[model samples]
Target: MINDNVFNGTFQNLSQKNMPFEQVFLNILQFMEKDPTGNFKLMFGTDSQVYSRETKFITGIVIQQERKGVWACFRKVILPRKMENLHERISYETTLTEEVVSLFTEDKKEQLIQIVLPNIYKGASLTIEGHIDIGSGERNKTRIFVKEMISRMNSIGLKAKIKPDSFVASCYANRFTK
Candidate 1:
């Protein structure tokens, strides 16, 4: 079980509200790298109308292999509305969780992370194949299955790809003792 206090939790909003563009973007990246094997929460910002695509992106759908590795399948939808302010940049962030993948505790988290991280994209086509209630509470939980905010967009009818350069531990360093 997660000790609860060790981790600094952040709020994930899924309402019709406005959020800091850079902050929200980092949140998605942190979320992905932390649980690479495959899990996510629907953190909503203002509608695509209010914000630009540069300020928004999605964590990949983490696919799981019954007895193998994990990765990410990331996605992005760049609309014309996005401002030129961030047009020079076109990459999604992904975090890698350190714990190894194993059984129920193993397969779903890291395995899922691996499958999805590698697949995230800004110009990809998506299809909301179905709906699932993953039970990740309002604050996002490591023990909880991923919670998705359904959306299926396309880049000329194809799913774009955000390839991983390498797996990063994503957080701070190793010297601190508990």
Candidate 2:
């Protein structure tokens, strides 16, 4: 189960209502089943925006079904006070993404692995990608942590991504960070 309340947002064809993480996750599973032949990529990531009074963190879960469109849900957390350093801030963002991925790939995997579904999840492999907010773009200060962050994720057996390739963090999750 997810740790925070999920906001389906414009994705999932649901209204902007908060729901239990488990229910939201289960709903996603059922939704994916609607198209058995669709190629789905599940990505998890987090992004943060620092304000004078607080830091807003948005963790997003994206299910991209190629050609069929996307379904996403996000959870937000606000911490009092801002992080002054870029490295530390990026680390925090990556950690949050890792945490959310862990909740699904490790925790929920064990809990839901028993469900005999017709999808690849039943007897095939399901790869989870972790998207980081750090980018290698020249104007981006977070580039320095790119290698370190990607290494951290790889060491945990999770494929890492950043910037342009990390739409889950840079685009989807970022949109809700405000």
Best lDDT among the predictions, by candidate number: 2
Estimate the lDDT of model 2.
0.71
Q: List residue ranges in candidate 2 displaced over 4 A.
A: 1-16, 105-107, 110-126
For candidate 2, write residues 1-178 as lDDT tens digits: 2333332322222364565567667766775666755566778888899999878878888777677777788777666778778888788877877766655656566433333235565343345678998889888988889999999888776789887899988888888876
lDDT of 1 by residue, 1-178 (tens): 3223422222223341234333444444455555444434321111111153333322223322223333323223233344333212111111101011111143433443453556555321112111121223465331132211212112112121211111111111011100
Q: How many clashes in each candidate?
A: 36, 0
lDDT of 1 at 23: 47
- Model 1: weakest 10-residue lDDT segment is 169-178
Best by TM-score: 2
